[model samples]
Target: MSVTPEAAARLRAYLAYFRDLGVHEFYRWSEPAAQALEPAAAVEAPAPSIAAATGVLPPATPPVVAPPLEIDDRELQPAHMLPPSLREPPAPALRSFDDLVPLPATTIPAADRPAALKVIQDEIGDCTRCPLAYGGRRKIVFADGDPNTELMFIGEGPGADEDAQGLPFVGKAGQLLNNMINAMGLKREQVYIANIVKCRPPANRTPEYVEASTCSQFLIKQIDVVQPKVIVALGSTAATYLLGRKQALAGLRGSFHSARGAKVAVTYHPAFLLREPRMKGEAWKDLQMVMRELGLKPPVKQ
Candidate 1:
């Protein structure tokens, strides 16, 4: 019988799943297959070869898996053949997960968070800390959402909708962000939101380095108060300031960097996403990493 393409895909998918589970050796497949593609690549492009999809080659070192319990497959199963408990799968051996994720957010008492955040806002009142303050903006867009959240999003600066509303992330890009958060099984209010510069930069250009640097202290203070477990730096400007240096978005993305005692994941800004929708998948992958740390499950596919 001819192997259907669908069957081939399912088989390869199973292989990849097993490979990650530490099952590298499959009699019918080899390691060359899994080497054809990388998980991070899968986010950027179409799926690769089946061999790559299904990791067939076992690791050079035996993976840390459940103890190898020998089981006889000589005959059909029967209750009389083996105890029910014996048929159970073994627990996986412990593996070093030390660097896999950041420590979970230290829980801040809800009652104290508001008062603490208020202190920062009060200090920022009628701010003219930088040239950004003269950018024809009527109000300062400080932030939005909960101060007690374990997740926070820091964007480059406010846009028209945000500046007019005196709130961060209330524009078309904000809508996209809302969808992104919903995909991660979270709400706009569940996570705190802020910006590198409280005032909108002229014509929505990148916040100038000096403006970003001047206002970053307040942003840093806000982060210190919230102490979110993870902070998503939207776009390169946000990343540069949060990470304390200039870096290509590509270079800065795809991993967690420690910033202000929190884990940070850098990705394209929502405004950029609106312009280049194809990159949304890549952005989604970044968010998934944050979700994993927060133990959040994505919304079910329709």
Candidate 2:
């Protein structure tokens, strides 16, 4: 059976991420696995790290000898596409809202989410399904982060650098976000970052009503894939859509709201704070709520 094109696209995005992490060299796969799943031709670099500029990792896992990464081509194919003799048995049905959180109650067994998320990304392939597709944009910026992370950040859409690089953030605004995450005693890779729409709107404008509505389904799927303990809506665009209504950021900014079964907090965009640096303090207040929720320590003053 052929691996669904949808699944293969994600494999590319996923591998591209590993490539960015500088850890791709630690492993290798057999030629068939490489040929079957190589997304090298499709995706460029993994979505840039808009959360943390550089990772703060635990001591590296001691290297151990292992068998060559040789996966069966049959395993790559989705069950629906496989022949009767090759098709594997279907797994048990997930309980209602099971997809919202991990099995056994929002914990371990992230349910192979990386692969599932890759499938979702593929489903959105070369997305001409909307008017936003036709733009000076080079590539669609899907998302960035560990698929199984516990904290997430969602913003409006791709900006100039983001569009050019095919990654979210990665501009002056992204640098500010990096500082925010660092202040919370967290690393960028510890949380997930995504935007409402994958494509960049013309002239960096806000995504249209139809655009946001259409791209939102993918965002919901992304949220479910991450199962975060809390999500910080990075601006009014993020807040308005995540909560599903038009409202001022003032009314929505100070407290926790619910969306896709995750605790949502609204805050100003980094780009806004750049123009109004005084507001960084206010943004910090919102981020502090995120820290408390995650039981993170405040950065001690030097």
Tens digits of per-residue lDDT for model 2 on 72-172? Answer: 45655878877888876663332222233343345335868888889899999999877799876678899998788778999999999999899887999
Clashing pairs in 1: 16-54, 24-58, 33-51, 33-52
Worst lDDT run of 10 residues, candidate 1, spans 92-101
User: What lDDT does candidate 1 reach at residue 13?
Assistant: 66
Cα RMSD of predicted structure 2: 28.0
> What root-mean-square deviation over C-alphas does model 1 reach?
24.3
* Per-model TM values vs. the true structure: 0.63, 0.64
As a whole number from 0 to 100, the lDDT of residue 30 in candidate 2 is 83
Tell me the lDDT of candidate 2. Answer: 0.80
The sequence of per-residue lDDT tens digits that candidate 1 reaches over residues 129-211 is 88987878778987889888899999989889888899988889999999999999989999999998999888988877668
Name the best candidate (by lDDT). Answer: 2
